[model samples]
Each structure stands twice: as structure tokens, then as C-alpha cells.
Target chain A: MKKIIMEKEAGRFCENKDIAKKLREEIIEPTIREKEPVIIDFGNVSGATQSFIHALVSNVIREYRDQAFDNLLYKNACLEIQKIISIVYNYMQLD
Target chain B: MDEKWVNVNPAQLALTAALALKVGKENAIIQSQNIPLSARYLDRMGLYNFFSTPSPFRQYRKKEPAGRFVPISIIKNGDDQSKFVTDIIPLYHLSEKNSRILSYIVGELVRNVLEHSFSEDGAVVAAQYYKESNRISFAICDTGIGLWKSLQIWHPKTDKEALSLALTPGVTGTTLELGGTSENGGAGLFFIKSIVKISRSYFVIMSGDSEYTLLKTRPDIKNRLYSDPFKDHYAFSNSISRFNGTLVAVDLKLDSTPEFQKLLDDIGDIYDSAVKESRRKPARKPKFI
Candidate 1:
């Protein structure tokens, strides 16, 4: 039941697929292994380019698509950022 | 008095410069760096004119040079403009070097206005016709979300300091992946500064709140020293608005030849591309009108 919270950056948010990939390896991989829930924060991190958000969110959704879903969750994504991610998630068929 | 505006949202200032050269009064070719001119635009020597056309203004394409001052403007909208100057350069009988110089200057001006900008009026353009010698000037004005608005994104500093950084290559306001600033680090305008130093044509640039004018001090071209000030004054418009419209000024020499005359269409393409770059509702060049 470890709650991992990744803080948000300014409006720019984090970019580069490499960063997203690294987070996948360290955070998502371990969380799934232990079946613990993860909550990422977007309190300060305002929003990010469509491409950057796509890279990160898609990765998590695909990895835990069907089996033991809802084990990992993203919390605190700004209203704008969350809205965009939700739209993209549906577009990606992760609903 | 008989000359009427023949454009459909010309590329702002480039078309104006070409038309100025084609005016066929003094038969002089002129060029201006890519930057917005003040509201003063094209007023000079009891001659005042304004409009925005296409660049690389040519009076005659093959034989004799074009007329005195061919009015040209950019007829554009926003950033992401792909070297439309390429289409117009060949007609000028300019070497790659010459084409690069003109395009580079224009690139600097147009890119800045397009990338870091926001305007309530959509886009802005203006040119002046110098009645006496028929030197129609080119200029585009915008309420750019000024350098300060841009800097607010990352840095904290004075408007002047922000402006200085603006020309510092790669110093654009566009976010990454959105084809952010200066692919080569926003060096477009910076490179223009040096090339202009060697040009025998009139070159001036005013970005953000800073102004750089070079009329008399230019390198020799074809053993001819080119230096003529179209206008040396700051222009302000919608001073209260956040605009990024940029004005370009240049007096082109349109040699009396049909080839140069044909350039009107070439300039047309440049304007067409502006609409695409800015991602605005597609618009046509003023020429067809």
C-alpha cells in the first residue's frame, strides 16, 4: 500500500520520452510488481505538450491495460492537463 | 493616384517592397531586413505610401533590372513559414549568396512575429508609397505578446534585456515539439545582423522594443555602395494589445523587363504560404484582386 506521488513542475511539465520511460522503469515497474497503488501529483505541474503527456500516460495505461487494473493511478493532474489526458486516454482506448 | 491596392492579404511587407520597386519611377532596386516598420511606415521626401506585398521584388526577370522601386510585402499570417523567399529569389538573378542574405533577413523578421505573437486584429500590415521618387516602402506591425510576455514563461527580466535575448538564436517563445524557436537556436536574426553589415542595400530591424537601423553603412555590392534610409522612426499600434505582427521595409529596383514583371506571381506564392504557416483560415494573395 505504498503511495508514490510524483510532484508536478510548472505549466511546462516534464518533457522528453526518455524521462517518461525512466519513470516507467522505476515507478510503474515496481508498483505493478508489488500490486501497490500509485498516485502521481499535478499540483504545481500545470500542463504539458500533447506529445509529452501522451508518451507517459500511454505507457502506464498499456502496461496495466487489462490485468489488475487501477493498481496505478495519476492524481493531481491540473484540470486542463487532466482533461486533455482523459481525452487522449479514451482516444487510446484505455477506458 | 491611379495605383490601387492589388492584393488579398499579401504577406504583410514583402509584397509592398516588390511593388515599390516596380513603381517604375526611378528604376531602383531596394531591400529591407525582416522586421516590422513603425506606424510611420513609408512616408518620406513628400512621398508617403503603405502596403504589404511579396519579397525579392523584381521589375524585369531576365534582361535589364526592374523599375526604380518595386513595392513588395510578405502577405503572410504567422510563424512556421517555410522559405517562401526561395520562389522569388531566382527571378532576381541573385546568386545563392544574395538569396540567402535577403531570405535570412526576412526570415528573422517574419519568424519572430509569427512565433512569439498574439493579436486581436488577427494580423497587421502596412506600406507607404514615396510619391516623388516612387519608393513604396514595406512594413508589418503587430502587438506581439512582447518579449516580456514571452520571458514571463521562463525568465524574469526587463523588456530591453528580453528583446536582446530575442535575437539570440533559439530564443523563441514557441514551446518544444511545437517547432519551438530558432531551429538552430533562434539564430536567424543574429545571422541577419552580420550579413546586413556587408550588404550594399538599406537594412533595418526593430524587434520587441529595441531598434537597429543600417542604411548608410553596408558592404559594397557590384562595386556599388547602397545606403538609403526609407524611414527612421519607431511605430506604435494597438500599443495596448498583445500583438506579434512585424513590418518589413525595402525599396526594390524593377528593371523594365517582362521577366521581372512575371515576378508578381512568384511573390504570390510567398503570400499563400504565410496563411499556411500561421494556421489561419486559408487566404489568397492580393495580386489576384
Candidate 2:
């Protein structure tokens, strides 16, 4: 299992898509490809923009589909973060 | 700028700052002499710092911008964006709940400029809290490629068309696909517009020769979120003097702000429905045979 701490990567407010893209490309994608469950921890993060959340996980959801959902875990996300993540999941899954 | 009495909002201030940067210090000048007392707000907002021409008015003691306003700032990269978001909440004297909404708007708008504007000078941002109105107003502008140019791959024939597509829920300049690519969902502006709408406030976007303004929703009327911006009450003009880059300004009424999670739920529902509806293949017309 691979753990990604959002605060360490994106600060308390995760709005930077560059950092998000980096996390996806460098960490999330590789772990998901290996079929290892990945946990994205948002413990200290206070809020996130929809764009940042979109960049971070939209592609993984697109590529992995059901497996991505089954293996990917979001821990300690605030309500705002969860809504944003859920929004991205819903839209991306529409395809 | 030499008007006898000048009154401008944060949007105008940021736009002027962007114009100053574009004209360069040598060509741009501000005449401070003969200015009205009200013009002091200009200096207070740090507009003078952008100009090479010195202020003719005597300098006043500087005050910390705690709980009132954020002066003109240039944000060039992600680090600057993060720091600005962190620092802005206290400046507005916003509560933790209120701060999230402001942070989200600022973050998405500034990030749009950084990622797409292609302006070396980055984004010029300014904001003020209107104590009388119980609202916050802010603007972000860039001298980089404007919306028309940025959306060129989509073959937008005019600036107005580009602005329309840019405001749509799922369309993006980055891709022709419905859901958009990983890095861009093209929903930033839409979400911002929705937030402003829900608050019954105004949101404006300008680029090239065109501008679109989301008019304040009437308090007496039912508020409905629309995936298509034009469906809402709005004003538009293609005749505005051409601006080479993009500028967006928002007025958020703090008092009217719904709970943060509730706002998200509302926006998320609209967004999901919009995307899902777009992807739904139109029902084939009944056979005429």
C-alpha cells in the first residue's frame, strides 16, 4: 500500500494543480498500475479546489475505472474535499 | 490616470495594474497631483508601486492590511498562489467556513491564469472587503494570451464564442473531449459563476474585445444553477476595447453565502447532471416511416 499525504504535497489548501499532476504522474498512477491499493490522506488539509482534485484523480479514474475505485482510498478528507472528490468521480465516471 | 476624482473597484484596479505592466514603466505614468482626497485609496491599495512615476502626494504611514483588503499583488507561480491564499483569509477577517469559499475562488482563478495565460508577468490581483455591503470583491488579470487565442484549437470564430465555451461546464481548451483531461476540467469559471450566482452577486469575465457579466440574481426570484451561462440573466458586449489577455472579477456577498458543504452539494449536483446529460446520446428521432 502506498500512502500520499495531501498536506505534505499540496499544503493545507490543495489548489495547486501542478503539484496535483505531479502526484498523479509520479505516485498515484504507478501505484494504481501495480494494482496496489493507494491511500490519499487529507488529514491536515483544510480545503481543495475542484480543479486541483480533478487533476489529481480524474485520469486515474478514467484509466482504471472500477479497479481505481476499489483500490483507491481517501482518508481524513474534510467534507469539502470529499464533495470535490465525489464531484470529480461522478463526472469522470460518466464516460 | 488623471481624473479629478477617481473611484474604482478591485476589478478596475487589477485591470489598470495589468495595463501598466503591459505598457511598461517607461510608457505608463500616473499623475498624482490635483487628485481628489478619495484617490488616496489608490495609494492605500499599492497601485503606485507599479508605476515608475513618483506619487506627488505626501506618503502616509503604512498600515497592515488586516481584516480589510489585499493590495495589488503579482502571483507568478504555484508557491505564490498558495502563500497568497493562506495570507488572504485573515486580511478579509473571514471565518474558517467563509474562508474556504474565498480561498477556492481565488485559487481556481489564479491557477487558471498561471496555467493558461502564458503571461510572463503572471496575474495581477487585488481585492477589497466592502464593509458597508458586507461583501468581498476581487479581480485577477493577466497580460498573456486572451481567451480567444487560448481556445483557438476549438475554432472559436470570435471572442464572444470563446467566452461562452470557456464558461460551459465541461468544455476545455485543453481537449475536445466531454470530461476534459486530467489537468483541466474547464469547470473553474463555471463553478465561480455558480458561487457568485448563489450568493446573488455579480461575476464578470473579459478578454479580447468581448466581455460577459453574470448579473446579480434577484433575491425575490428562485435561484437555479445553469450549466449554460447564457441561460442566466446576463449582459454581454463584443464592442469593448480589445484587451490582449483575460480579466475576471467577482463580488461575493458574505451574508448570503450558504454553508460551504451545501454550496458544494448544489454545485456538484448541477455539474454531475450537466456532464451526464451532455454524454447522454440524444434519443433518436422517432422513425417517420
Please, what is the TM-score per model? 0.35, 0.95
TM-score of 1: 0.35
For model 2, residues B150-231, the per-residue Cα lDDT tens digits are 9887899999999988888887888878679889988999999999999899999999999999999898998899877889
Q: Write one digit per residue (lDDT tens) for candidate 1, span B1-289.
A: 1133222222334333333433432544333454232222232211123323232333323322122222333334422123233333344454433333344344445544554555333223333333454322334445445566765654736544554454342234544212232121233343343233333234344444454444434233222111111221223222222223233344322211112112222222322232223323357757864
Per-residue lDDT of A1-95 in model 1, one digit per residue for the tens?
A: 54444442212333233444556667766777677776666666534433345445555555566432477566776554555455435433412
TM-score of 2: 0.95
Alpha-carbon shift of residue B25 in model 1 (angstroms)? 28
True lDDT of residue B137, candidate 1: 39
State the lDDT at A94 in candidate 1: 16
Clashing residue pairs in candidate 2, if any?
A: none
Residue A14 of model 2 has an lDDT of 93
In each prediction, how many residue pairs overlap at the backbone (N, C-alpha, C within less than 3 A)? Answer: 89, 0
Q: Which window of 10 residues has the lowest lDDT sum in candidate 2 chain B?
A: B55-64
Candidate 2 per-residue lDDT over residues A58-82, each given as its tens digit: 9999899878898899999999899
Deviating ranges (above 4 Å) for candidate 1? A1-95, B1-74, B77-87, B120-140, B154-156, B174-184, B200-203, B207-209, B214-289
